[model samples]
Target: MNPWALSGVVLVAAVTFYLGKRSSRYANTTHDFLVARRTVRSRRNAAAISGEYLSAASFLGVAGVVLKEGADALWYPIGFTAGYLALMLFVAAPLRRSGAYTLPDFMEARLASEPLRKLCTVAVVAIGVLYMLPQLQGAGLALEAVMPAPAWLGAVGVTVLVTVNVMAGGMRAITVVQAFQYWLKLFALAAPTFVLCVVFFGTGGAGSAGSLGDPAPPVFREDTTVTVETGASFEVSEETPVWLPAEEGGQRVWLPGVRYEVDEGTTLRFPEGAPVPAVSGGEMDNASWLRPAEDAGALLGTYSLIFATFLGTMGLPHVLVRFYTNPDGKAARRTTVQVLVLLGLFYMFPVLIGALSRMYVPELLVTGRTDAAVLLVPSAMLPGVPGQILGAVTAAGAFAAFLSTSSGLLVSVAGVVATDVLAGKVRDFRIATVTMAALPAALAVSLPVEDLSLSVGLSFALAASTFCPLLVLGIWWRRLTWPGAMVGMCVGGGLVLLALVLNVLSEYSGGWAPWFIEQPALLTVTAAFLATIVVSLGTARRIPDDVNAVMLRLHAPDPLGFMRDRAEARFGRIEDRSRKRGKHRK
Candidate 1:
């Protein structure tokens, strides 16, 4: 009743997943534990990627931005989906071809140096930790909003649950779980959206809607108003207050201050004490960009979001690691495409829900929890038992979102920790998994003080700074030596660390700050890419010939040895047919 949908969703999610624990036993071998035994089909793997990729930021945060900013919110989803396309075109096949379990493994082989490997390992762990914090914080926020639980309880519960699942099952277990969670998230969002749309328009189609007459025009329900003292001498009553109450549910709901609509470039200000007015179609442009500071930016915001999404996907260790789960490079490529389509389809609903919320759940604006827009939209739009059922579905979706992404992040971290930290040193893989998973829980406790999305964005920027350069160069450039990789990682990683430090100090010290958030990714990534390239070019003479052969093996399916045999088995038949054809022609 009090917007406890998030808590109910999280509880149901934990229980559903807990009951499904036996499924984790499927991951038995190191390969299975690391990459789901490299047998994940294209469609399912794609869905899983899309599932994990669509975090709370996309589902809830972006939509809230749209409610406040208008068209700009559309960019978050567009950029996210398009990023998968980039993965499909550039990174997917090559990454799979690398035949490495973790990014560190790939770095070790490519750079042929332990130091580079260590750098990669540290970066992987750092990025994973950074990424995990938001999911935990969002989980806490979701739980607190949905249930009567303390925010920290949500974080603790999710961290523990995710740690257990990831450590117990590893990649093998998480693959299945993420896949199931993806469909669950889609269903949860889709089911509620469909019902809400019906409730919004009643039995009639869009043209016969009750609220705004034919093809209901979007309306704003103001929660708080800002009163500006212009110091103009005028009659108080005749001078109309900038904001006014609109009759809704038999009460005059008013916003306190001057409200202006930004239709294209025109500003339509509602004079003080005027009744809140509804604008149709073209007229709604006045209020467009003036609603909130977060929403007042331009399309550049979308492009920035997209840049982060597309590049960020390549840098995400969990998403990249999934490429290893494919049977071969081709399957990996196929999986990326599948993920793109699924991600695109799933995104459409959130944008709609957020847009719809602009009209119905405007109360969230007053409540200081616009992030809860996704969960609250269904309840606010659809009344009675139907609304309750829809609310449960939305809760389930949000829970699935947290669970899937959190599971993937934890699995990626555990993999890096096991292979790099505890490899050969730890007697048991299970023990290693537990240790790796628990460390992030400690980090999650410190996240609430920061912005969750920005934390994730910084993780992306850092990721782009370090890995994006490392990956593109590793795959495309042949001259990259160990020294190049090591130096490049340091340059990129250092920049990211520096940006983060500056941001923290600025917040703590209250001083003028640098362009830490705005351009960190662009600068760090460029420097790292350039450093790697220049260093590799300088050391080209010492480049080994073995690299070509290894790369060939990485890219092409050899009949005798593909990932210890799987790739070649499929290609072996093709080679045999060619030989037979030659024999027949002779």
Candidate 2:
């Protein structure tokens, strides 16, 4: 076991628990627990939002994609950062002005329909669950960098940590934890990046990284050993010799050329400058990898990916819930601005690691575990104690990414379950935290780990297909009817889920559908928007009577003293201008 790596994990956990317990003291009421009484400041809330937004996919998967796909993978981070731009421009101020605690609350408030609110609550939970799975899987990958352990350990550990922290203080507590984690993740990534740059670019180091324009596949920069965790098929570009470790403590043997297949637990050592075999399912030379689109199918997937991430931000329940923690519409917008800057800064390090990994850690390509590139690179580049220390730091940051995002997701999930599924009580929220995390933890431990970014992108596609339209239309369009919202979300969410099922079936049956059908966002998002519009236009007479008043509340400046929730009786209000003037101090 690497003590430094283990220590970093312990340190982060200690800090998280300490902050959570400290914050829990003030979160006595439901409002405080759910939205931090809307007292979080712009900068602090932005940090927390950034923390939660940069999940395992950003920490490891972005670099993994870059290492594998090269220039084309640049779109992942671009799409991710661009998403918040959409959120800020279209949804941020307006959503905050709506005075809703959850996405369901927003729906019900906007449409004045209880049935539609219930549907939204269900969608929030579904998206939260979908997003949570990657965080848990990322936890497993992070732990492996520290020490070899069962996949279940990381999932269970993160679940318990998230549950304890969330159950203690909810959003109020997690805001602080997530904010701290954002910086921690930044430092974790930035430090290694600096050292690697010096080692790779500076004199007396590894020398210049290989040119990106090379047409050949990435080769081992130095002799490397790669262990295949499961039986898998991948193709080697050329005949190459390799050293294979024998089973049952037998002697090692030099295998000549064309090692095309590997079984579980197979360990193969390659000589320096040997071609790194590409994964069997998809293989590309450096020239193709560097380019944006390969063919019709890949080009379609790229468009779908960008579309899903950009529009999908509004649909993410965890992200939108954070805006409620801001005091007003302006604060939410300011928070978004800060979030954009912080996200832009954090994303740079991932691209650096990914680009460098192409030269430094190509064994991952052969192993089909490209996600481990960031975790493995520090030690691979810098030998001895320095590498170990950096490795530990990277591992800690990875864990923090998992915990930070998972905490936010758990809070959002618990909010829906407690408010919509249960009695909407403090006790119910506490119960819901555990209940929401339990299923995902179990699934994370049992299920096979997929591509982290791909899994997360699918969650984005699902959200984009469903709630993106619900949100964009609900906020902008006055004619949106309850039936329209319901039909649109259901149709959109249903199609994505159907595509997922089809994807599974096709994967097992070896009969995958075309790119649009498998990816689905490009088509599904359009379908949802059309469905909502068509249904609402057909049911034009069903618009809420107070649509004008609600629109005034949403669009009006903050000083007007328009009601927070004029139609809802849950919150009290100030009334009578003469009486208020008489009671008012200068």
Quality of model 1 by C-alpha lDDT? 0.65
**Per-model TM-score versus the true fold:** 0.79, 0.92
lDDT per residue for candidate 2 within 1-586, as digits (tens), equals 6789889998998898998888777665576567876778899999999999999999999999998877778888998998999999889888888888888888888898999988888788888988999899989878876887877798899999999999988987888899899999999999999989888867444532355667877777777788887666666656555777655343333223333556777888878776777765454467766777768888898898888888888789999999987778999999999999999999999999997887777778877788988888888788788988988999899999999999999999999889888876678999999999998998898888888998998899989998899889888899999999989988998999998988878766544677876678999999999999999999998899989988887878777866383223432222332233232110
Estimate, for each residue in 93-124, the C-alpha lDDT of model 1 and write its tens digit: 87777777788888776667777788888888
Q: Report the lDDT of model 2 for residue 538.
A: 94
Top candidate, metric lDDT: 2
The residue pairs found clashing in candidate 2 are: none
Q: lDDT for model 2, on a 0 to 1 scale?
A: 0.83
Which 10 residues in a row give candidate 2 its minimum summed lDDT?
577-586
Best candidate according to TM-score: 2
Q: Identify the runs in model 2 with alpha carbons over 4 angstroms from their true place.
A: 203-211, 221-225, 242-269, 281-283, 563-586
